[model samples]
Target: MQSFRERLQAFNKCVCDGARLMVGQGDYGTYVAHIAKTHPDQAPMTEREFFRNRENARFGVGNSSGFRCC
Candidate 1:
């Protein structure tokens, strides 16, 4: 059984990670793990490309992409 402090720490980490994801912060460790398991023969994208690709997928290309205020 985990102690209260340990559980609290875990919960805090989960919340922080969730917030980061919500704001488009990519998880490189998980990405690497996935690539290692599913595409061992292929090279993974560099960290910069990973984040850029994520942003492109989330928002998209051009001036119309993302939030706009008039």
Candidate 2:
């Protein structure tokens, strides 16, 4: 199984690719946040806050119960 960082990296890459396809390489934080909300494992945050917290952020992707995003 891929680590959280690996999964996040993949997710970011996909977001970037999609953004590039649609709007040309720029910002896709809004889209990323939207996708994150739909997935059980992904953490949801506003586009502005997502970038601000991503570096030290912890998500509860693999563990739903007895876990919190911090």
Candidate 3:
């Protein structure tokens, strides 16, 4: 039996996660969970590294021109 506060917190997390997905962002905590569950022998990246990798993936690698054009 979950307490009211716990239920509310879970609901809040779901809402926030949905909004984040709508904005093309990945949750670091979810990434950690996946790595833990699927690859017990592997290590997950730190939060900063995760975001940097995500950014690089989304915007392509920067070039000598200093900008990424689609």
Worst 10 residues of 3 by lDDT: 61-70
Error of 1 at 19 (Å): 1.2
Give the clash total for candidate 3. 0
lDDT of each: 0.80, 0.58, 0.83
lDDT, candidate 2, 1-70, per-residue tens:
9999999999998887776545323344655766767785876556566444543333333554534544
Which scores higher on lDDT, 2 or 3?
Answer: 3
Clashes of each: 0, 0, 0
Clashing residue pairs in candidate 3 are none
lDDT of 2: 0.58
lDDT of 1 at 28: 78
Query: What ranges in model 3 sit over 4 Å off?
Result: 62-70
Q: Positional deviation of 7 in candidate 2, in angstroms?
A: 0.0
lDDT of 3 by residue, 1-70 (tens): 9999999999999999998666556899999999999999999999999888877755666655554544
Q: Tell me the lDDT of candidate 1.
A: 0.80
